[model samples]
Every structure is written in C-alpha cells, then in structure tokens.
Target: MPRVPRPAVVAAAALALGTLAIAPATGDGPAVTDPRVVTHFDLTRGQSPENIALAPDGSADLTLSNARQVVNVTRQGRTRLIATLPEVANPHTPVVGAAVVLGIARAQDGTLFVTYATGTAETGVWRIPARGGKPRQIAQLPPAGFPNGLALDERRGVLYAADSVLGTVWRVPRAGGAPTAWATGAALEPRNPRPAAKVGANGLRFHRGAVWVSNTNAGTLLRIPVREDGSAGAIGTRATGLYAIDDFGFVDRHRDTALAALTGGSEVELVRPDGTHRVVLTPGDGLSNATSVAVRGRTAYVTSAAYFTRRDPNLLLARVHQRDRD
Candidate 1:
C-alpha cells in the first residue's frame, strides 16, 4: 500500500508564510508566488496515470497504470486510446488485477517505449509505433526486477530503466538488444524501514551527460555520470530530504534545477543544484498526489494519480504556469 503523510500544522503555517513572502514582485514578468492549476482533465476511476511523455506536436501521451493502456491527449484536450496491453499473471500477490503498465517515453522519431510489470518475475520493455500499433517486446528485464521509470538518449539510441524492486538501473539499445545492468549501489535502495515500502529508484532521466534518478523511499535525487562508451560512472547525490520523489522534470537546464513530484508528501518541490528546495505547489493548489511532471516552455503538465487517497480518486491532468523573472 502507498503511504500518505499527514500535513503538519506548523509546516502548513510555514508554507503559508513562504508563499506570502514570495508574493509581489518588481520585475518585468507577471507577479507570481505560487503555481496555479490552469486546467484539468478528470479520468475514470482506476486509470491511475503514472508517467507522461510530450510529443513533438505539443500533445502528451500518458501511461494508465491500472488500466493497462496508453492514451494520447491532444493539444486541444482530446484523449485517444493508443493501445491496451495484454494482461499478465501476477507473481507477487494473488490479487486479481495487480498488473500495471508504468513508465513511458517517446523517442525523437516518435516511437514510444514503455515498461510493464505484472508484480511477477517477468517484467520487460516494449516498443510501440508512432501512430499507435501493436507493441513489440524490445527487451526483458531480469527475473524479480520491477521496472518503474524510463529515460531515452535518442542521440545515442540508448534507453535506461529504473528497477525499483531491485534497486538497479538497466540499459538497452533502441534497436532491440539484450538489456544490461548499467549501475547498482546501496544509494538506490529503499531507506524506509516499513515493509510496505516498495520503491527505490523510481524515476530516471538523462540530462547534460548524466543520468538522474530519484529514490522514492530514500527521498534522494542522485546523479550518475555517463561515460563516453555510454556506461555509468560513479554515482553522486544531488539532493536529499525529498519525500516520495516520484518523477521529476528539468525546470532550468542552465541552472541544473528540477521540479519533483513528491507523491506521498502531496507537493511539487523545486530542487536546485546545491540541494536547496522549496514547495512550488501542493494539495491546497489542486495537486493531490501529484505523480509526474512534463515541462514545456514555462508550463508544467502535472498528473495527479491520487493513488492512495480517498478524498479524490479521480485522475487529474493539470497545467501549472510559471512566469519568467527578469
């Protein structure tokens, strides 16, 4: 079961103070202190959208975890079902509908790569065509591995996936080849002592010659150097104390800053290169269990899965606008 932390009274007061202090600006851009939800889409119950990939045409493709489907949301807010994955038997539990489709990424050529886990020993990555067709298995991960997040290096034709259960990262060629264990260490392991904590390395991204990963259970953001041969070098910590950091997106490429979706914490954290961070949005701002973020220009497309919440079980896809500061 997913853990949800109760909002602290003192912390809530501090957030209100922080938000007020950041208000009122003397700049060229609009005066802004917090992110606001511009619009949202309400999905059916149990869709449980996990990750999203932005298309070149300004559309967004999302992975429906519990529904086991891929959907394309057009720029005009039209949603189209792309594909439905075949059901696989769960090996971890006897639950009837536990299999899930998790991470997704679109290559430069428009081909989509997705990761699916059946709560079983058989988990793998599959490739789908640009216009949506039958999914072809590209590579299968090791037994007992639970792949969660995917990152692609389109220039190098390489794809990386994070194995949450195994606390490892796997790499595979985009042209269909064997998956190799790229990196492994204790830093990727889950730090929470709770037996129900399942995630370790939850999200993976390739940025500026490094592979960045988020550990949901450890509340850490780590950077793994990429060698010339595409192999991983020594791992380094970029930020910590980020609770339930799920999937994040780069906010400022030049500054090496990112916005992370803290699922259990019900907040989106803006993390800097120096480990400094602050909440940019929260449940009070209509971000209940925000799971993933896809940034385009100054707007962030955030998904609220509300996985373990009873308050709002509907899946929401919302936009948060950020103003430029002079």
Candidate 2:
C-alpha cells in the first residue's frame, strides 16, 4: 500500500470515480457489467487478499496481508489455509504500523513463494513446500525495506521482489539464495520521501523480456527491459494517470493489454498497448478498494482489500471481453 492514510485514499478514490461518471462509454471502451462476488472475507480476521495467483484447478492462492497467512480459495468459494508465517519478534514496520504479508506467487509444482515485511531481520522472501509444512525464509531483505510485490521467472530460475519503500527490485534464486538488487532508479522512488505511507514500485511482473512495474506515488506503469545477460536495461514509462495502481495482469497472451486494479480509485482499468486506458469496473460492480487482479482464459479475478471501506473485503469474478483491434 502507498504510504498515504487509508482515509485520504478513500476520498481520492471517490473523487476519481465521480469524474469518470460523465465520460462516454463506447462499445470498444469501458463497459459496465455485473460481476459475481465469489466470497466476502472477514475484515476483523485480517483476511484481506493482497495479491493473487491462479491455479490450474481453478483455485486462487492469496496472501492475507495483516493476517500473515496464505490461503487458497477454490472455484466454489471454499477457502483453505495453506500456511501461516511465523510471528515477527518485533511487530512494527517502518512506514506501516504492523508486520504484514504482501505478495504471493505459485509455481507449477504447487510450491508457494511470498514476501513478509516485519521491520526486522526476519523480513524477506519465504517459501512453502507443495506438501504443506513450515515456511522457510529463502532470502533476507532489508529490515526497513517494504517488499510489496513478487514475480517468479520460472524459465530463468529467478524471483523478483519489489521493495516499495526502498525503490528497488531484488532478485533471488528460485531455489533459495542471497538476493541482489536487480533494478533501481528515480522512476521507482516515491515523489515525497517524508510521507507516512508513500510507496514506489508497488507491483512487478516478468513479461515479454521485460519487468513491468507500477509506481503508486507517480501513478505510472514502467517497463524495464531484461538484457541478454539477464541484467536490467533502460526503464520506459508505458502508461500514466493510473491513480494508485496496486497490481495488474495481462489480459491476453498475444496482446500487451492489461487489467489493472486501482486501489485508491476503487476501479479496474483496461490499459492498452498505446498507453490509453478506460475504467472497466467500479464500486457499482462490487469493487471496494481493489488491490490486485489475475486474468485466466476469459475470466478476471479481482481481490478487494476494503482497507478504506472497512467493510466487505471480497473476491470478485468477471468475464473479460477482447477488443477487435487487438
């Protein structure tokens, strides 16, 4: 989450969506649709779904941020506990108040990888076995760095973790090893360093020979080329005006179009290759502070954290339509 207060974000979200209400909705543009709520989580239990990874069996694996738990929500909305990260010796985080789990990614073999920000030596990347047992720390990150998003490059045997507070992306061996700072620059740093909750480089994904990242402070999406030698190349700004984009996923394999979750805007946007975008889903579609989105086949799964609404944190299922131009 950005270093801004939740209440402040709530106000911004409402204002942004209100402005979109008067915009024209063409057939090829943003369309209003009724999305199905798969399940509503208990906010008191800290069951806020932060990042999602879809399984082949139609189940979704998620990290319950404040709860420090990893769970699987099946197609039928049945949720099962996969693993709970061990408690941090110190619960306080640098910018955030408490220790929390953030991003999650699943491997083909059912193994799970996640990030934990504990503001202590324990803060780092963790791995849970496919058979389900204790979670082990694979790499230790900076105690003050808030690692917010994670992505695994299976082909390269590399795992990239984004540090929102540090404005850097760290790479670790998939099997477990020391992490190296893979990418860092001004584009990844928060505009204001003194803000309580300001964040940068909030989400990450390895796509098409580049690492796509979201800058919450700048409201821009960036693409960093992966060089032939597995090093990061120059960074390019792909899109802007994305208010509080938390996480996003590609809509089609052949197209660069993506469905991005706007946390502070309480909306889902369809971002095109040309950097144009339109709001596709909103509060009317059951979105309450959407945090992350995962697209599979013709379906799009969105997770609402409800950090601002303080009400229904839920998982929503919607159908995705492709444009003829793509």
Candidate 3:
C-alpha cells in the first residue's frame, strides 16, 4: 500500500462525511461514575478510529477512518500498524474527493475484513492477513452506495456489509466474491434530507440468530432474520430514539440488552429489548463522538473518534453492571 498524505486525506474525508463539527456534550444524563481510559492514539497514529474487532487473546483491531490503516492495540495498550490501504479515488463528484476506511471484522482463523468507499460509485471490502501482508479485494459494492460496517458469520462462511448511503445490507462469500443485496428498506435511510447529514445504516453485527444493524440518521436499531436458505428475511425494528447510534455490542444476549455508542449524541447508551435506552457515558466521562463499542466479558470498549472536530480520539473502557436483571 502507498503512504497517503494524512492531512489532505483527513480533510477530504471530513468534508465528504459532513463530520466537520463535533460539539462538546452538555446537559445532564446518566453517565458512568468513572470510565477507565484503556488506550489513547494521537494524530500521529491516526484520527477517527471507527470500528474494533477483538482477537482470540483480546487484542483490538481498529480501523482508522481518516488514516486508511488497520492498527492493533494490545490488551496492555501497545499499538502497531497492520496494513495501510491505498487512497480512495472518486469517479463520481469532486465533492467526495477521497474515500476513508471504516468497518472491520476478524475471522476465526485471524484473517481481517475491512470496508471502505471512494464514493458511492466505488466502494470496496478487502481482506488482509492476520500479521501483515498484501490486501486482496474481496468484494466490490454496487454504485451509489457507501459500505460502512462489516460482520462475518464464520460458520456459514458468509460476510455482511452495511451501506450507509444506499440504505442496504449486502451479503458476500467469506473467501471473496461478488456481493448481493441482502436487505433493503426505508428504515435504513436517513430521515432528514439535508445534504450535510451523512447518515444511514452504520453498523452490522450478528447476534442471537439474527443480523442486527443500527441506522444513524434514523436513530433506529433493526434486525433481519437469516433464513435457513442463507438469505435475509423480513426486517424488524428492535429499538428507536437512539440518536446517532453508530456501532454497538450486545451486553446480554439472553436479555437482549446492548450498549450503543451514540456518536452524534456524544454518549454511550444502554439499550433494552423494548426500545428504551439510558445514557451510560458522556463527554463528562471523556466520550467525544463515541463511534463503536466492543464488549469483552463485563468490560465495554468505546471508541471516541472525535471525527472532524478539534477533540482528539481515544479508546475508553467501562465496567457495565446490568442495571436490571433479566
């Protein structure tokens, strides 16, 4: 991969995503008494870390949305670059300028899958080796879509990606092949039509026999049943009012509870099966533009991307004791 200039690419992504201003969180909300800072990455490493995948040993594989690199953070807080992606070239409009790397997932055997977009016309999902090796293009998304989040069903050998711009979820083979639309509906699109509002389906996760996804622009959580034939069934709403909900993790599968990172709201919310939620962490607790959450045991790892704002990005950990028993 080529060493793309950071300053220019970061600026171009910020502009394209409409994440130029990240306001400081204010007002009163239920916040974690004291969240622990697990790790911190300055501009030197990358900016706007979007998603995280945990290795078998609990190390974190992070996708830098602005820097176009996959970095590994050890349980002890050490960071190392695993791979750098090529600069995204937009064939559509000059407004997009460049593409940024976003979602990531690790396979059982340690292979990594990543999603990136140069424009809606050119989006890619690539596969990279566990240690560090050449990246191979696994799938190319259809035109007029931006692939953001990725989830893999290792047992079924299926990979799913969420497109933020097209409001669609795609299915592909784990070994790299053509992608097909798995699910599509109005619930995945942004509610507001403002051009600056870059929102849609943001995160993809496979949980409890269903494929779950979060809609950032609509502030809704939805799930699609994975049919026995390996196709998607009807889409159902799991929760709503989760404003700016990005990536999230299940806290208790049996209880159907999850911790969602509300990026636009600048807080981490504990969502219930009934569509109700409560703030678990805020900027007061050091969360700035919280993007993704990964749970290991009882500890939840949240990424504060800060996005295009002045606030720097870092990772935070919080011990989440179930508020109410199932």
Candidate 1 per-residue lDDT over residues 73-136, each given as its tens digit: 7756677889887767644521112667788989887889998776554468889998999887
Arrange candidates, best TM-score first. Answer: 2, 3, 1
User: How would the candidate models be sorted by lDDT, starting from the highest?
Assistant: 2, 3, 1
lDDT of 2 by residue, 7-39 (tens): 545445543443222223233633325588898
Per-residue lDDT over 1-326 for candidate 3, one digit per residue giving the tens place of the 0 to 100 score: 01123453343344335422222333332234459777776766556688989887878899887688888987777888899887645444112335678899899889999987666544678899978787778788865667888999988998899987788898889988888888999977755454334467888898878899998766778989999998888999888767667899887556567788987656888776666677778888888778898887766788888764437688887776655554
- Cα lDDT of model 1 overall? 0.71
| Cα lDDT, model 2, residue 165 | 83
lDDT values, one for every candidate: 0.71, 0.82, 0.75
RMSD of 1: 5.8
Q: Which candidate is the best by lDDT?
A: 2
The TM-scores of all predictions, comma-separated, are 0.83, 0.92, 0.86
Error of 2 at 153 (Å): 0.4
**Runs of candidate 1 exceeding 4 Å displacement:** 1-45, 90-97, 120-122, 193-195, 311-326
